[model samples]
Target: MGTSTAYGGPGGGTPLVPSWLGSDGDAGGLASPSAPPAGAPTKDPASPATLPPAPPTRLAIPTPADGSRFTAPRSNFTRFAGSGGSDRASLGRAVSGYVSKSSGGARQAAQRMGASRGSGARLLGFLTDVQARGATEALRSLDLEGLAGRPIDEVFMGLADYICPNAGTVDEGIAREAFIETIVDLSTLGVTDLDALSPDQMQTVFELYATHAIEARLCNDIGTKLVTAPTDPLIALRVQSQLRDFIRNGVSDALTAARAETPNLTQDRVHTFVDTIYERAFGILQTLGDAEADQ
Candidate 1:
């Protein structure tokens, strides 16, 4: 759950791309050429110099409307847990049932983003287009370029919006965060060339985004709603961490299973691929919940 402000600096020991790519640059882009030197003799109208300079290629900055925080529901469990009426097993069952019931809604949210005409599908189209064409061509089609020279984090936020298109929903926020996180992670994972990222790299990005989104969704859904917080602050943090890891394991398994079934992951099939992953992931989560209830 890193915030956008925390992304200002590159923390990894060494970036896979050139140092400049990870460093902050003139976000304003080149200022319009100084009015052609105040009436100095101009080149022929037909000459390249006479052509208007290309628009400044500024990376997009996110506005408040672009993203929102997940609003957790009031903790109904906390109300009764303090009275010694509920035990850990009952709490576990309540969490499992609640999350399992919510799985349908989560899957619907995922579908809205993954289906054709959704931002997630568009994101996949961009990646697959990169694979079919070159990265440069794909970017051009999307009106994005000069990425080789922009700050890595800036490029990340800009691209996140393009990929998820903040519908102002919690799910979209989760997806956008996941997209940026994937980029930040890739900076250390041998993704040396942003302008020419390979198809495998693009697919890796998508897959990681999906994993992060699922984990975030689960965490938001379960936080303090079904499980009461431990009194110790350190224990609370650890509990949260462990909960994330537990859910992430199930998500990973689902993605692995889905990937195995659809070995070729192309744009045409990305929607179905993602839908299958969501279905399997919720199923696995429900199974895990059932196990917890038994315990």
Candidate 2:
């Protein structure tokens, strides 16, 4: 089959989307750019489906100072170029140009995808929904091929696996690993680039991961009042940053320390501001934990 596969002795095989690919939905405003709809690609005997995405030599990390800014940074490339990027071979470069290349790319994705299948988990479907939505957003903002120098599919697969390996199969631990990796990876993406992500693109990221923001409204009315209305609003600032850091680092350290504890630990002022997310996030966690225990 390897030697004869290229000969095309039989009539051209069916022209259809592969079974591995699914019909990704258009999430609200997110857009899904199908990988380059190339003439039915001739499969290499060695490489099925498509060649693997280029492995990154190094991860691309935005400067930490620049990371703190909420505005769109300078365009490393021109505006999103998915439509214009050449699909000649799929991605031109690899993951490095778009996101950081960590030590465990393939092994991690494979592990996540593999473990999910073994866990009798429903996490994959949920994550697939998430990825498709995120993919939609990322596609709209990115230069699909020029960024990769490959077909949009390569970009999609690269991003998809990176974001949710074994999206439809992984267990909780693998799912958690993949989720953390994705958020960390997205942090490197420019705000403009992230804001430009298609629905499918945004789907892979988190609901709370806002790329652009205004610092002035960092807190709501209640929060301002709770902090003695400090001009700096120190405590509220501390919590917000702690949550942000948790999202990035998975809560390794707590924001509140004995020495740093605020003198004013009273008043219901901040509760109004923090209650909404705290209630919801905690509720979801409690519910999920209960469900897992029951199972």
Candidate 3:
């Protein structure tokens, strides 16, 4: 009697296994010795309609645990000509020039106000005055009614394009460093009280510093670019508007972050803190502007 030819046997053309079973050995129970070998082309390739649906992709959202220090991605800005080397050097020069002049102005204002660099309270008061006067003068022309409902950061981000249209032209790294240095100088003026804040609150504070630093650097770059015609009233107003919006948004973002991190943080306390920081930054700019005019 001849051997049964139900499965592939000698001189049999039929495969021992079905072609639908994946050829990989790891196909688990679905795989069988009767399946065709892996990598073998199918006579009729599987159509998209026949394939199983792909699993959905999930997006990860950043949380407070991710840390509060957020740096903008470098790719967000355009690369400078000759790559980053020359661009960086140019940006460094601009930062150095602005910091030197602004620090001198701030020191002079501090002395005149009888507020030592270490006196946080007196310095805060002085900054408050400056901010009020600067903001009043800066926004006297523009209609700000539309901005009342927007998030502080969103408003500032929008003004970023108008205030410092050329900011994207500078190297992001150099601009970031300059901004960080400026924030440190503000700390020397006793603007921030680190001991009073919780760790999470401190993170929010640093995030605000980082945000404003970038904005200030952009303004500085804009000023440097306009050195030839600095007296243009229109240009000055535009820069002032940018600075004001930057301060406003920086304070708002810090408070918002603080609230998120510390649920117990009261809205009233956040408002007070935001007001203080915003005024202080605005005042500093006002003094800086005055010193520049005198020079």
Candidate 4:
């Protein structure tokens, strides 16, 4: 593994892509633009990575003709992201479950966006569209490229500590404190009536949460607690309950749509998808549990 000059930077420690053309960002940040993940199955040529539609007549979200200003936070981000790991995973699952209920083009795009290789937040956003638009036109108004770092409270107020803060004198250290407050807010939201809204509507509720003033304040609170303790269990339970509630919503919606779209889609198949959503979440729930234990 001796790097002569080709891989070395100015002196020897620096390294650059073999070819010098564009950014090293494609297929998201998980893999090299030209390479797939190790041992990952190659996607079918027929189902290429191009903007493959989810349905023949799917209505897509209007993606920003250009990209959004949402760059993932730089530096100290590991601390911020790791602290919110449980929330990110749980939210991703909830969003994924809701979006997967559709049988049309929205479903395809949702699956693509929610792919394991994609960002947790991005997956949540695509899922948001499905919940907002319904299975039919869910994909019609997506602005995927425009939602980067939009804010966690956009979906979960407790997670607001993960959003844009008072872009003033606060540094990362102070912002992390603000994030702590967000955790409190998110904890409160998690405990709300999960059964009140349908799965799709519940996801919409999260979308609304992301925009409300309460979430912003939560972020401010977390920012005040910088290197604080992990979020509480009552909060964790609420988040978990929300996850299950979200799954219920998606399952119910999927069953309804399946009956209408492919008359052949059996109740059993719908159950299978619901189970899939639940199963995807088990790992996240475990992580949340562990975090609570540490507290």
Model 3 per-residue lDDT at 224: 27
In terms of lDDT, the poorest run of 10 residues in model 2 is 212-221
TM-score of 3: 0.24
Off by over 4 Å in 3: 1-172, 175-179, 188-204, 216-228, 232-247, 254-258, 261-295
lDDT of 1 by residue, 1-295 (tens): 5322122222122221221221111013334675554335556667756644445445444222101112211133343233243344443454455444432333533432331124445566677776777666776776777663565455556666577664354445556666666677777876656556665676666666666565554444444332344555555555545545555666678877876787667777876666676666656766775686587
Q: What is the lDDT of residue 6 in candidate 1?
A: 28
Identify the candidate with maximal TM-score: 1
Candidate 3 has an lDDT of 0.33
How would you encode candidate 2's per-residue C-alpha lDDT over 1-295 as one tens digit per residue? 0111112111112111112222221112222366433333455688667664544334233222222221111121111112122221111111111111211222221221222222112222323332445434334443342333333334434454433344331122333343443345555653224324554343334332211000011111011222222235454345334323322221111112211343232223222212222223322322332343243
Q: Rate the local accuracy (lDDT) of all candidates.
A: 0.51, 0.27, 0.33, 0.31
lDDT tens per residue, model 4, 1-295? 0111112112111111111111111222244568654555555578866543333322333232111111111112223323444544434422322222211123231232111211223323434444455422432343232333334343333233323223232122222332343344544566333223355444344333222221122122222222232376454334433433443444334334533554343323433333333233332333342343344
Q: Rank by lDDT, highest first.
A: 1, 3, 4, 2
- Give the poorly placed runs of model 1, Cα more than 4 Å off: 2-95, 103-119, 149-154, 187-192, 195-204, 224-234
lDDT: worst 10-residue window of model 4: 1-10
Of the candidates numbered 3 and 4, which has the greater TM-score value?
3
Per-prediction TM-score to the true structure, in the order listed: 0.57, 0.19, 0.24, 0.21
